[model samples]
Target: MRVIDPRPLPPGVLAAFLDLLGPERAAEVRAAAVRIARGLDGGTLWHVNSTPRGGGVAEMLHVLVPLYRALGVPCRWAVVDGDERFFDTTKKLGNLAYGSTEPADRLGAGAADDYLAHLELEAAQLAGVLGPRDVLLLHDHQTAGLVPALSAKVAAVHWRCHVGVDTPTEGSAAAWAIMAPLLDRADGVVFSVAHHVPAELAGHRVAVVPPVIWPFAPKNEPLPDDATRVLLDRAGLGSGPVPGNVVADGPRDPDAPLAVQVSRWDRLKDMHGVLTAFAESVPDAHLALVGPDPAAIPDDVDQAHWFATCLDAWRALPLPTRERIRLVCLPMDDLDDNARLVNAVQRAADVVVQKSLAEGFGLTVAEAMWKSRAVVGSAVGGIAAQIDHGRTGLLLDDPHDLAGFADLVTAVTGGAVDGTALGDRAHEDVRRRYLPDGDVLATAGLLTWEIT
Candidate 1:
C-alpha cells in the first residue's frame, strides 16, 4: 500500500459554496461538518482504491478527501499496489459487476486465491499504518477483498461501490456471489444507487450515496474562452505545435460545432458507437473522443489494447469522417494540468454526450453538466438518475440506438433544441444533487452509523 500525497487545497475553498448553497444551506453544511467532527473523536478517515490518477474513483477521492479535511475531518488517501495479473483479475470482476457478458475465466478458485494473496500483503501494510480509532472506506471491487483482514484493525470499515447495472444479469449475479461473502465483514456498504446492492446482502447496513463533483476542481472549474482556445492549441487539437503528451490526428475545426465525450477507453463507455453515430448522421459537427493516455494507468492491463483498437477503428473510417473525428489522449504526468485541459475541452464543447452502455455513476456527465454545457446521455445506471430527459439534459432510452443517438446530437447542433437552456437547467440540477455539501452530510451519516 502507498499513501498518495493530495494536492494542497486551502480550507477557505469551502467559501466557493456560499452563493451556490445560499446562507441557510451553507450554515446547515457548516453545522453538519461541526457535528461530524465531534462524532469522529479525532479518528482519521482513510480511503483506499486501485489508482490515484486515472478514473472517476481517484478523481472523486482527490476532490472530496481534501474538502473533508478542510471541513476539520481528519482524512488520508491510499492506493493499493497491484501487479498486472492482479489488475487484470480485478478488471474482469469489475466488468462482470457492471453486467458485462464477457467470459469470466479469471473468477475461478485459483483467481480468488491470487486476489486474496495480493490483498493479504496490502492488509498487513495497512494494519501497520492504521490506528484502532481510524475509519477505513474501501472503494469498488478492487479493494473489496481487504474487508475481512482489516476489519479488526480499524474502528470501522465501510465499502463504497461506484458501479452498477440498472438490470441484473447472470454475469452480475456470479460476480456478486463471489464478492458478497468478502463484503459481509464490512461495518456497512455504500452504493451509488439502491439497485446496485446485491440480494445476498439484504440485511446489511447499506446507504445510497451518489458520487459528487467539486465545482472548483480543475476539471470542472470555469475557464475563459481565450484560455480554453489556447489550451486546446497546446494540446494539439488546434493550430499550435503539438505537445509530446497529446496524440491527435489533425487540427480540430474551430468553426464546426464540437461534440465531446470524455471517458476511459473502455468497451462499456461505447466510444466506437459515438464515432459511428457521428460519422453517419452528424455531418458538419466535429466529435472529439477524449481519454487518458493508455500507458498511464498501469493497473488497467487492457488499456493499451483497447486504445489501440479504438485508433484502428478511427483509421478505418472514410477520409472525410476521419478528419471530423479527433481521438485525443491527454497526459497524466501533472494531474492538475490534465484536469485543466479537460475543463477547457468540455467548456469549448457545443454538446457533451455520455453514450455509455452501463455505468456506476457517470461523473463525466455531472462534470460537464456542472460546467453548464448541454448534455445527452444514455438512460442507464446513474446516468438515468442524473439526467431528467429533456429537462436538465437529454437521455437516450436505448444505448445501442446509433440513429437515435445521432438524431439527438443533430437536434442540439442543428438548433432544433435549445441546448443552452438545457445546459442552464443541468447546471442547477448538478448543483442540487451532485455537489460535496450533500455528499458530506450523507457520507457523514454513514460514518456515524458505523461508529455508533
Candidate 2:
C-alpha cells in the first residue's frame, strides 16, 4: 500500500462544509445521520459488492465504512465469492440492466440452490465472527441475490443500486425476478440518481443517495511535487520540465496544452469517440487517455482475450494521432498514485473531457470540478446533473460531434470564457453537491428513516 500523508480531521474541513451547506441545513442533516447511527446500536452494517476492488461502489465503500466507524457506527465491507463462470453470468446481467439482450444461460432451478449454498457457507463463516445485530447493506444486482438467504439472520438489509435503470430488458427482468424476492425483503433500496430507480420499485421506499468524494482522504488531497514526479515516472508519462505536468512523473512544457480523459476502456465509455472528438477539435493539443484496461479482470471468463481485443483497437489508431495519445493501466493497488495523476492532470489541463456514452453519476466530473478544472462531458446520465452549460463546465450533446466538441475545447482553451470564473463556479458546485459531508448526512437520514 502506498503510504499517504496522515489526514487529521480539520476543524475547517467540517466548518467550511457547514458554511457551504449553511448552519441550519447542515445541523439538520448531521442530526439525522447521528440519529440513524444511534438507532442501530450494537448492530454492524455490512456492505457487500461484486468485487472487493475497482469500480465506484467499492471505491465509495473504501472510505464510507471507515468514516462510519469514526462516527461510532460499526460497519464492515465484504466481496461476494464467485468464479469466472459466475462473473460472466453477472456481466450478462449487467448488460441486461443497461437494456442489452445478448443470450445468456439461465440461472436455472439449481442456480438458486447453488447460490444459496454459497451464501449460507459465507454467512456461517461470518456469523462465527460477527454477532447477529449487524445490518447488511448490499450493493448492485450481483450480490442482491444473497439478501433472501440472509434476511432471517440479519437485522436489516439495504440494496444500493449504482446503475441507471431507465429501460429494462428481458435479461434485466429475469435477473430482477431472481433477485426481486430478496429486494422485496430489504429494509430499503438506495439509488445514486432519481432516474436510476425502476418503476416496479416505486411503491417500495427508495432513497436517492449520490456517491460522494472524500475531500480529506489520501486519494483526494493535494500531492507534493516530489511525490507527483515519482508517480508520473512509474506511469511512463516522462520526466523533466514539460507543459502542464498532469502525469506526475511526466515532463512538463509550459507552452503546450493538454486534454485528458480518464475512464475504463469499456464500450459504454466511448473511449474511441473521445479520441475522434479530440482529433477533430484540437488537433494540436496533447491527449492522454488514462485508465486501466477494461478487458482486464480479476475474475471473469477469457479476460485476457478480451483485453487483447481492446489492446488491438488501441494499437490500430493512426500513428500521428496515436503519438499524441497515451494509454496507461495503473495497478489496482496504486490508487494513491492515480489520485496524484488526476490532480496533476487537472492542474495542467486546459480541459478535461468525460465524453462517456453512458455514465453512473460521473465521479470524474465531480473530481475535476473539485479541482476547479474546466470540463466538457457528454450530456448523458449523471454527467448532466453535475455540469451546467457555460457555468461549471460545458455539456456536449453528442460524443461523436467532433466539430462541436472541438469548438468548445478551442474556445475554453483559447480564453473565450473567463477561465478563473469557470473554475471558481465549478469548485463551488462540487462543494455544494458532491462532497462527503453532505453525502454521508443524506445517506444517514435515509437509513435512519428506513431502519427506525
Candidate 3:
C-alpha cells in the first residue's frame, strides 16, 4: 500500500466560497466542517481507493483530502496495491455493474474468493496503522473488500461506489451479489445518485452524494484567452502547430467551432459514438476526442483496447471528416499541466458533450458547466441530476440514438439552441450543486450518522 501526500492548496481557500455559496449555504458548510473535525476527535479520516491517479476519483481526492485537512479535519489518503489480475477482475466487475454487454466469465465465485483474499492481505497492513477512532472511506469496488476486514478495527467503515448502471441487468445483479456480501460489513454506503444504489443494498444505510469539482484546481481554473492560445499552441492542441501532445491526422482550423469530449478511453464514455455523430452530422465544426495516454493509467486494463477502438472509428471516416476531427491523448507526466491543458480545451470549446452509455456521475459535465460551456449528455445516471434539459444543459434520452445526438450537437454548435445562455445558467447551477462544499457537507452528514 502507498500513501499519497496531497499537495496543499493555499490556506483560506474554502473561505472564498462565502461569496459563491451565499451566506446561508456557506454557513451550513462551515458548520458541517466544524462538526466533522469535532467528530473525528483527533482520529484520522482515511480514504482508501485503488490508485491515486488516472481517474475522476483520484482527481477529486487530490482536491478533497487537502480541503478537509485545511478545514481542520485529520484527512489522509492511501492506495491499495493490486496485481494485474486484481485490476483485471475489478475492471470486469465495474463493466458488469455498468450493464455492459461485455463478457464477465472471470467474475465468478472463485474470482470473488481471490479478490477477498487479496484485499484481506492488504487490510492486515492497514489495520495495524489504524486507530480505533478512525473512520475509513473505501471507494468503489476496488476497495470494497477491505470493509469486512477493517470494519471492526475502525470507528466506522463507509463504502462509496462511484459507478453503476441506470437499469439493472443480469450481469450487474451477479456482480452485486458478489460485492454485496463484502459491503454488508460496512457502516454505511455512499453513492453518487439514488438510482445507482442496487436493490441488494436496500438494507444498508445509503447516501446519495453528488461528486464535486474544485474550481481552484488547475483543471478548472480560469485561463486568459492568450494563455489558452499559448498553452494550446505549445501543446499542439490548436491550429498553429508547434511540437505538442495531441495526436491528429493534420492541423486544425484556427477559427472553426470546436466541440470537445474529455473522458477516459472507456467503452461507457462512448468516444466512438461521439466521433461517429460528429462526422455524420456536424459538418461545419471540428471535434476533439480527448483522453489521457493509455500507458499512463495502468489500473484500467481496457484503456488501450478502447483507444484503439476509437482510432479505428476515426479511420473509418472520410478524408474530409478526418480532417475536421482530432483524437487526442494529453501527456500525464505532470498532472497539473495536464489539468491546465484540459481547462484550456474546455474553455476553448463551443460545446462540451458527454454521451455516456452509463455514468455514475459525469464530473466532466459539471466541469464544463463550471466553465459556462454548453454541455450535451446522455440522461442516464447522475448526468440527469446535473443537466436540467433545455436549461443548464442538454440531455439525450437514449444514448444509442446517434442521429438524435447529432441533431442535438447540430443544435448547440449551430447556434439554434442558445448555447451561450445555457452555458451561463449551467455555470450558476454548478456553483449551487456541484462544488466541493456540497460534497463535503454530504459526506460529513454520512460520517456523523455512522459514528453516532
Q: Which candidate is the best by lDDT?
A: 3
Model 1: residues >4 Å from true position, as ranges?
Answer: 104-109, 241-249, 450-452
Give candidate 2 regions above 4 Å deviation.
Answer: 1-30, 102-124, 127-130, 167-178, 238-254, 293-310, 400-403, 450-452
Please list the residue runs of candidate 3 whose C-alpha ends up more than 4 Å from where it truly belongs after superposition: 104-109, 242-244, 450-452
**TM-scores of the models, in the given order?**
0.96, 0.83, 0.96
lDDT of 1: 0.86
Tens digits of per-residue lDDT for model 1 on 185-263? 8999999977878787787898888899888888887788788878888666666765665545567777999999999
**TM-score of model 2 (CA atoms):** 0.83
How would the candidate models be sorted by TM-score, starting from the highest?
A: 3, 1, 2
Report how far residue 227 has shifted in candidate 2, in Å: 3.2
User: After best superposition, candidate 2 residue 304: deviation in angstroms?
Assistant: 5.4
- Residue-wise lDDT of candidate 2 within 168-229, one digit each (tens)? 65756766666666677887888777786776676677888778877665555777778766
lDDT of each: 0.86, 0.66, 0.87
How many pairs collide in each candidate, listed in order? 0, 11, 0
Arrange candidates by lDDT, descending.
3, 1, 2
lDDT of 3: 0.87
